[model samples]
Target: MAGGKLTARSAATTKPGTHGDGAGLYLVVSPSGGRKWVYRFTWQGKIRMMGLGSADVVSLAEARGLRDEARRLLASGSNPIEARREQERAEAGKPTFGAMADAFIDNKGAEWRNAKHRAQWTMTLREYCGAIRSRPVDEIDTEAVLSVLQPLWLEKPETASRLRGRIEAVLDAARARGHIPRNEANPARWRGHLDKLLPKRQKLTRGHHAAMPYAEVPGFVASLRERDALAAMALEFCILTATRTGEVLGARWSEIDMAGKVWTVPAERTKPGRPHRIPLAGRAMSILEKLAEGKTAEFVFPGQRAGKPLSNMAMEMVLRRMKIEGVTVHGFRSAFRDWAGNETRFPREVAEAALSHVIGDKAEQAYRRGDALEKRRALMDAWASYCEPPASNVIKMRKSGGGSAV
Candidate 1:
């Protein structure tokens, strides 16, 4: 009776409409009259049951095969229930590339100086690393990284190289944290690996410096002068004084001395961390005077909103409207240096001092203590004259030892 096959009618008669097969393996009849095959077994000293199949779908022989397989696994010291659970857990533990990248950025982005730099780092990763975004971080290999970087490598080498380094860092972090198995060789590294494959980036073409020629400056200034009631005046003032964009934009009324004709930028705002004394030229003073007229605010160029200086973009936008391309507002300092070197006879020290540039040798800076304000005053006057429309008659000027025009 244990081994014999019984017809459904005979089993039903013997069981009297009760719902289970006689053996440990059973066909349970539900209220709806559907029969399902289930097996009860012991694995690792614990009782367990595995559903073999629906009796309607699986033949008796097929259900026996499934039951035998489950029993064999249990007999071999494997807990079938636990094994299935672990398989599911392993699948869930695998992290997507996007998830890993976000983790990497969150951990590393705080080291950057500002929000702009942090934003750039994340944006590049999101844009170029899209292919592997959903792929498991543990499974990402050189080929996977290559698929993301290869297309942009030649066309945008700098961006591609940056993307590669960031991707490598993310994977390396994952590896260290046991999220992945090992430190996979970064496909993006240029020195030993990628450099062998791609053409080297030009060293000279690395950074952006937007400077304009000195010869074209007079015409540019003339064009700027024709524009009215714009931040072009402040930008032009910045050029005449040989100061920075931030210095001009954030300039307060308190810093300017109308009697002394000097603008002293505080040490905090200056790049060199030393207070800079700019000898205000006649043209620069004139512009400041115009801005001060009818303006009751503390800032010379106040923002449309109260208590704030002018927006940083205001001056740059003014330059763009003037149709002057390839020249940054900050690069005007370079233009001034070129003019001082080529057109005028001002000493290198005086010109450099005018730009608030830190000079060589700390000993020299300690020894040369004089600010040379009067001398700078005359030099600034000459610069202002040059910026103005040239008269038909030329005037010869002599240079003084203190860097003033005689």
Candidate 2:
């Protein structure tokens, strides 16, 4: 049976041991009558047996062809078995960018503070990075990254910056996992690489947010008073509290302590994943009291839909209706910050705390014990008075109570 092709009938009858069909190829027969093709070869003075295919599936001609291919590989000094394993490994390594990004998000998203941040990662990659999502991560180069970023770089600089960072992170993870070669330069790197190709974000000449002048906030509140919509009330509350729209919109009755005169923003609702107790000012409490009258819903500001809080855009719509062009709802916080800095004598730390901003480095923050709620209450009181001043003639009042001139 050695060194020649065996007929199908002869192969069927050849029971028991090994029968050869030429160069390093043999049909292995089990005592029970099972038969399969094997390619036997020697590389580096070591003999190896590699399975070609089952005789029932692979014809005698096909088995001979496989034998010839294996002989060629062995003649080239490459072990056929090792070569086939390398080819299998290469095929197994080809993962799409979308798949890699999903894995990265799943592994890292748990550390993120809020669901919205995680959602943004998926949305930005899917929406803005469609060009590279189906491509392999190792195959992504600077051109591929720039193709996703360039169009949005100037127009949506902030989003573009975030997208670039996300891509860099995913690529870094890919390299760490051996999906991509470690020596390959990350195409999304910003410092010395992408910065040369793309324009500096600061030079793009875009406003951070459309903020009304701090001096004009009182008059704006006065104008807001004339509107009767729930959104208007919510806007006024947001301005008075200097809170982000999502915090105010997601407010529930359970969070407010009427007796304590505080609104406890939970860790889940906050940007930093730390619970903050906002000292509700007299005016803020008054607004809540008004809303409480005959209100059966749990939300502080119920939306048009039942069992839901106000939409994120509700306050923005109120501003639009009033023809308050060039000012964003979120910008009111900046207005408050400016007012606190320029017109008030409160310490900068106190003012920053009022905004629920992370005040210092991790070490500094750890040493800082309380939120300075008493001081913030006084500051918020003064702020509410300034926004709803008895007279339109605005003047710097003498600092009073616990939050005195610093």
Candidate 3:
């Protein structure tokens, strides 16, 4: 076989036959009238063959160019097929963590139960794990991972912990697919390295709820009541329903069923990635009704821009305006949970369900779907009554065992 250029026009003129060019290259003409370029070569002292492509697809000039390149690789003691694969891998190595993360998110975002979860995954990777986002996955190391977490390890331990774990998971996935090496110790694992460096987080304090006292809740609610606007209404609704900030901010009017007197938060909005039914208490309904009165926007709390939800910081600003310090908007859910557990007679499961929290064993949570909206309604109604101005007859219980009824 000899190597040379073969044009479509020349290929058409050739008779139906197989002929060699010089080296190991050949032009094969089929009976049905198809033309192709084939390369016959010796690799590792063994006969090898490869197709350059069709004369139409790979021009005669392109085929010769590939053959020349393959010959050069062969001279360098490399198998042409393996060399070609290596070249392909080198081209693919350009994808950075940020790029791969985007691709992964695009394919997997739909599988997430809610928009918040999807957003959190991307946001944390982009904002917190800055080193890994754009750097190649294979290049990520313990030091690189520590750069992202070390600064916040003590101050924002929980967030830092989650960011570390997520980064480890991303890298582990890349490693599993042979994009990187395996058995890399997770830089985020606290049990060994991080724990040795940082102060130990107390076990008793691990799950301690950071919430404002109930005694201060009325003052906070009263302060919020003075504000009049969609943001205010949304915040009030959040407080009444004991929902998260994202849930309240992202809520749409369509989710509220006025006829059914219920607000059904879809799985995408709920924290547990499941749908939650909230029985609209009289107060919560009133808040919604007032906001819906002559309102044309689709969002429960419409922003200044058309078709957009209210800013995420709207409720946080409300808390700040009330001069409440050291309390996050999210901590309000904790406050509600505290009130429900200590101040009300509602069952633990009912309170947990009202918060859209997954409780008990994983199997138990998997089996439980309903949010016990009716029971929650009663609890919310009582909560609303407590938050409202105290009635004249409502008595204050004494420190002693017995006290006069209201």
lDDT per prediction?
A: 0.69, 0.79, 0.68
Clashes of 3: 8
User: For model 2, what is the C-alpha lDDT against the true structure?
Assistant: 0.79
Give Cα distance to truth, residue 47, candidate 2, Å.
86
Q: 76-120 in candidate 3: lDDT tens per residue?
A: 545677556445656877556666666767877899887778867
lDDT of 2 at 210: 62
Worst 10 residues of 2 by lDDT: 397-406
What does each candidate score in C-alpha RMSD?
23.8, 21.4, 19.3
TM-score of every prediction relative to native? 0.47, 0.51, 0.51
Q: Write the number of the candidate with greater lDDT, choosing between 2 and 3.
A: 2
Candidate 3 lDDT score at position 57: 82
- lDDT by residue for model 2 over 7-102, one digit each (tens)? 878887887999987778889999888899999986534678999989989988788888888787766545677567546645877776877898
User: Residue 326 of candidate 2: its Cα lDDT?
Assistant: 68
Which residue pairs of candidate 1 clash? none
- Over 4 Å off, model 3: 1-106, 109-209, 391-406
Question: Which residues of candidate 2, in runs, are more than 4 Å off?
Answer: 1-207, 389-406
Clashing pairs in 2: none
Name every residue pair that clashes in candidate 3: 1-22, 1-23, 2-21, 2-22, 2-23, 3-22, 98-133, 114-268
Give the range of the ten consecutive residues with the poorest summed lDDT in model 1.
Answer: 397-406
